[model samples]
Structure formats: structure tokens, C-alpha cells
Target: MAALGQHAVSKVKNAESQLVQEWIAALEASGGTRNVKGDELKADTREFLQLITSSLENGAGTAIGAAQWEDTRQFLERLSRNRAQMGQDSSQTANFIFALKGPFFALLQKEFASEPQLLAEQLLQASELFDALGLHTIRTYQASREAVIRRQQEELLELSTPVVKLWDGVLALPMIGTLDSQRTQVVMESLLQRIVDTGSEIAIIDITGVPTVDTLVAQHLLKTVTAIRLMGADCIISGVRPQIAQTIVHLGLDLQGVVTKANLADALALAMRRLGVTFTKAQ
Candidate 1:
């Protein structure tokens, strides 16, 4: 594809301020300026426009993948990630680049008004260039958003599995929601680490908030119990409700060799008894 012409580049450079104003106005009118400060938006538009004009002058063709466009690519990557972090959608992020097309085409039209064919050629090149950049911004935005989501998920996992010291030599893990292999791994790691940290002799896995219990959940529970045992700590499975008990029986899942309780209170009592600790009610 043909590169942006020298005449077009000169016009864009000379009309940089005008182009930026028009571009920013267009973006603002289209509601693309949401969540962005005025000064910051202007600064970004100014910088991007400058980079584009300079890169074009230096022979950066419509092929944005060219080496000459490396700086521009980096700029867009940063822009995309920042926009994603700012809670902007992919279309809005990409529109930051696509929005410039109008101002650029207007400049080219004025620059090549006398030469219709040349105007068309330059317009096409500019469109192609901006489209490529916008697509790159979208792709980068998606990747950044995915990274943010994954981080949030990991944080949620850490939050959901909290190990509390109920008494001396006893740790309690209150679990909510479903139990999958991924969550089981996190649970085991957290419980085991707490056991090591406090040198606790017993750990209770409470599932009062768990909505349902299937064979998979039982298996996960067993796995966690086995891991805790391997860590030299006894594991007590608590919160075995009537429905869950029936499910376990219906599934014929064997929780053999694992102590279970109807509630956390009972489990704590059992743990305390096993530790040979006795507590009396205050009179």
C-alpha cells in the first residue's frame, strides 16, 4: 500500500493543533471522553498526533508494523492498557485512535483539493493506517482487561479462604461457594501455611456457606484433608448439613477416616477435646 504522501505529512504537521482540537472535539461529542480529564485527553491527543506526523515524515508507511512505528506502537499499547485500567470499554479505547481519522482526512482533503486522485489515495492510506492502529489498541485493551480479571480472581480466591486461629493449636477455614480443583489447591496451600505458621495441631474446614455438595466437592474435601494430614495436622470437616449428608449418601462417596461435624461450633469443640483442652462456662 502507498505511504502517506509528503504533502499530506506536511499539512498534518502544520495543522497539528487544529487537527488535535477537532479530533478531541469529535471524541468528546461522541462521549469517548468519559472518565478522562480534559487536560490529560488533550495531552494524549497532542502526543499521538505528533508521533503520527513525525513517523510519517520518517517513512513510516501505512504498514503500522514497520520498525519506524515502534514508538507509536508502544504509545498505543500504553494508552490501551491505561484506558482499560480506567474502566473504558474496548470500543471507547479504540475510538481514541479512530477518532483521529476525521481530522486527518479533513487536512488531507484541504492539502490535495486540487488533485482529486491524490486526495483519494492519501485518504485511503490514512484510513488504513488509523484502522490498523485502532485494531491494535483494541487487542491490547482486551489483553489488559483479561489480565486485570485474572488478578481479581486470584485476589478473590485468597479472600474467600481465610484461616483463623480459633484456639491454641487450632485453625479454622470457613469456606463459601463451590469447590473446584483450583480452589482446593489454594485452600490446601493457605491452610498448610497457617498450620506451619502457628504450629497448629488441628484445622477445621467449615462449609456452612457452601450451597451444595457433590462427589467432586467430597473429593476436594478429602484431598484437602489428606494434605492437612501430610502437613502433620488433623483436619475436621464441618458444616455437614442434612441435604449435604443425603447427597454424600446418595453419591456413595466415602469420607472414611475423616472426622465430620454438623457445625463449626461442634467441630471446634471436637478439636479442643482432641487437644486435651477443657473449657468451662463462666458462672
Candidate 2:
């Protein structure tokens, strides 16, 4: 596709300030600047206009993927990510680029009022360029939002599996959800880290809040128990409800060497005894 004509580029460059003002106005009218700060939006508008003029001047084509438009691509990516972090949706982010079409098309019309063919050609080029940029912004916004979701999931897993120091030499992990491989990994890392940090000799894995136990859940528990043993701390499997015990038996799961307890209190009592942590009522 043809690059934006030099005349159109000059018009945009010369009327840059006016273009930004009109673009910002268009964006606000379209509700694109709903949660964005006025000052920040104005700064971004001015910087983006400058980048567009510079890109076209440097022979950058409508194909934004070209090396000539690398700066523009990076700029848009940053803008998209910022908008995503600000809780803005993809449409709002894309509008930040698409809203510029108004002021830009107006400039083109005035610049080529006498040349019909040139006006059509330049308008098509500018339209394609803006469309490409809008698409890029949307794609970047989606990627940024996905990244935020993944990070939050990891943080929640850590939050869900809390390793508490029950006694001087005992750590308790109170699990409260379906036992998945990912949660298992988080549990093992957290429990093992606490063992090392507190030098605890006994670690209790409590499943009182776990809804159900299947073969897969049993395997996840086995892996965590093995990891705790490798760190030289004994593991206690607690919260063995009647239904879970039946499930374990039906599944033919083995728990030969692992100690089992009926509840967290039993597990803590056993742990305290093993740790020789004595408690007496005040007289």
C-alpha cells in the first residue's frame, strides 16, 4: 500500500497541536477517556501524534510490523498495557487510536481539497494505518489482561494454602479446596519452605475443608508428603473423614508409612507430643 503522501504528512505535522486537541475532544466525546487522567491523556495524545508524523516521514508504511514503525509499535504496546492495568476494556483502548481518525481525516480533506485522487489515496492509506494500530492495541490489551489474571491466580494459590507454625517445631497447612496438581505444587513449596525456615520437625497436612478425594487427589497428597520427608520433616495426613477413608479404601490407595489423623486437633496433639512441647493449665 502507498505511504501517506508528503502533503498529508506535512499537514499533520504543521497542525499537530490542533490535531491533538481535536483528537482528545473526540475521545472524551466517545467516552474513551472515562477513567484516564486529563493530563496523562493529553501527554499521550501529543506523543502519539509526534510518533505518527515521524514514522511516516521516515518512510514507514501502513504495515505497522515494519522496522521503520518499531517505535510506534512499542509505544502502542506500552499504552495498551497501561490501559489494561487501569482496568480499561479493549474497545476503550482501541478507541484511544481510532478516535484520532476525526481530526486526521479533517486535516486530509482541507489539505487535498483541490486534488480528488490524492485525497482518496491519502485517506485510504491513513485509514488502513489507523486500523492496523487499533488492532495492535486490542491484541496487546488482551495479552496484558491475561498476564494480570495469571499473576493473580498464582497469588491466590499462595493465599489459599497458608503454612502456619502451630508450635515451635510443627507447621500446619490447612487446605480448603479441590486438590489439583498446581495447588499441590504450591502446597509442597510452601510447606517445605516453612519447615526449612522454622526448622520444624513435623508438618501437618489438614484436609478438613477439602470437599472430596479421588485417585488424582490422593496422588497429589502423596507427592506433597514425599517432598516434606525429603526435607527431613515428618508429614502427618489429617482430616480423614469417614467418606474420605472409604474413598481411599475403594481406590486401593496406600498410606503404609504415612501417619494419619482423624482431625486437625488430633494431628496437632500428636505433633506437640513428638516435638515435646508441653502445656499446663494456669493454677
Pick the lDDT winner.
2
lDDT of 1 at 203: 93
Give TM-scores for every candidate, taking all chains together and pairing residue i with residue i. Answer: 0.97, 0.93
lDDT for model 1 comes to 0.91
lDDT of 2 by residue, 1-283 (tens): 6799887788889999999999999999999998899999999999999999999999899999999889899999999999999899889999999999998999999989999999999989999999999999999999999999999998899889999988888889999989899889878887888899999999999998899999899889998888888888899999999999998999999975789999999999998888787789999
Residues 1-283, model 1: lDDT tens digits: 6798887788788888999999999999889999999999999999998888889999888888899999999999999999999999998999898888887887788778899998888888888899999988998999999999999999999999999999989999999999999999999998898899999999999999899999888889998899888888899989999999998899999997899999999999999889998999999
Worst 10 residues of 2 by lDDT: 1-10
Instruction: List candidate 1 stretches off by more than 4 Å.
Output: none
lDDT of 2 at 10: 85
| TM-score quality measure for candidate 2 | 0.93
Model 2's number of clashes is 0
Residue runs of model 2 more than 4 Å from their true location after superposition? 277-283
